[model samples]
Target: MSSPEHKQKIWKMIKDIKVGMLVTLDNGVPRARPMHLVQDEYDGTLWFFTRRSAEKVFETAGDQDVCLSFSDQEEGVYVSLSGKADLTDDRELIEKYWNPFIAAWFHDGKDDPDVALLEIKVQMGEHWKAKESKTFQLYEIAKANVKKDATPNLGENEKFGG
Candidate 1:
């Protein structure tokens, strides 16, 4: 696990890597999909979007135990957010983070029947060697050489952007 300072840097890296590839299991089969996260300040909820018919929708249904992976290629930082997924159609939340680009996903834009929200309540995660523990230039050399297991262990229910 990382020291307090390193943990802070990892949090920031997670915030930067907002777009995660969510991994789920469907009938004992594994699946991965790229997802965009919307940070909610009200309840500190993590919000994501997807189509109703997507495979993830089915997999995340019976059980939301899933993994969200984010990485920074340049900085060599990786984060894995493991959590349980939940489906919701919260109108207020949809309106709060609604973007015009989302229109393409919904015929009703904000009211599309096929649109649904996937909320991942974080459990625990792992983060790679970030720059906080070393000089900005030297961290990469050290991190690249470190083994995956030795990188860092981030414990349960950690939040980012605050």
Candidate 2:
């Protein structure tokens, strides 16, 4: 079982880093590409816009298992999400998450025949977020290096599930 607070924290980090690498298995090899996360709410699911003819759609069709990796370097936050990706032609969802940025990709707009949605039902996730400033982190690392018996305090690492 997971706590609501953990879920909220994970969602907050994900929202903060809107773009993530979506990884899918292509012929038993991992293939990844940067994708924009469009969903506003985190309810054990994430959404992305793609074209029907996209290679990712075909890849997911073969193997639903996928991973989404997010990183906010300035904030020192990194997250990995494991889930199953499904491709859909849901017009309702397309319209709900539509924006001008997305319009640039879909030249024909939401009604474009190629418009498609990639939905990932997240099953588990892990995140590492720095609890201290970079300078402090460097100081801790230096201290640890000098004191071989000490362990460097870096950040919070948590794993949660839906």
Candidate 3:
């Protein structure tokens, strides 16, 4: 299980990523697609909006296990989350997460029956963060080389329940 502090850190890393690669299984083969993160909070779950007719819906029906990967290279943060995906047509939630930007895809707005929400019930997550500045990283590298030490601190590597 993740402590509240860990969850907060993970949330901060991913909240602004905006886009993530959602991976699902299709006929036992891995298929991935870029998905927009529609919600603001992390809290052990993630929300995404998608068309009901998308292939991922069928794929999830066959296999609930999925993975979401988020990265911000400039910030040196990356997160991989494993979860079960569920599709919902709850009108209230659809409206709650709705925005003008999504209208281009749904066309008919909140009332569109084809618009579906993907709720990922995250179960496990792993994250890597490089907390050092560029100069510090360079210094560490040089120190390691001079000391003939192969181990270098590259920040935190944590695994926790989502």
> How large is the C-alpha RMSD of every model relative to the true structure?
6.5, 1.4, 1.8
Q: Which ten residues in a row have the lowest lDDT in candidate 1?
A: 153-162
Ranking by lDDT: 2, 3, 1
Candidate 3 deviant stretches above 4 angstroms: 142-148
Worst 10 residues of 3 by lDDT: 1-10
State model 3's lDDT.
Answer: 0.89
Residues 47-152, candidate 2, lDDT per residue (tens digit)?
Answer: 9999999999999999999999999989999999999999888888988999988999888889988999999988888999999999989999999999999989
In the range 1-162, model 1's lDDT, one tens digit per residue, is: 334565455557677777889999978877888887766331324678777878788888877788888987666677876778998888897787788666666767777787888887765676664445335436545665686545433222344431
Off by over 4 Å in 2: 1-3
TM-score of 1: 0.71
Better of 1 and 2 by TM-score: 2
Q: Pick the candidate with the highest lDDT.
A: 2
Report the candidate with higher lDDT, 1 versus 3.
3
In order, the Cα lDDT scores of the candidates are 0.70, 0.90, 0.89
Best by TM-score: 2
lDDT of 3 at 35: 93
Q: Estimate each model's TM-score.
A: 0.71, 0.94, 0.91
Error of 3 at 28 (Å): 1.1
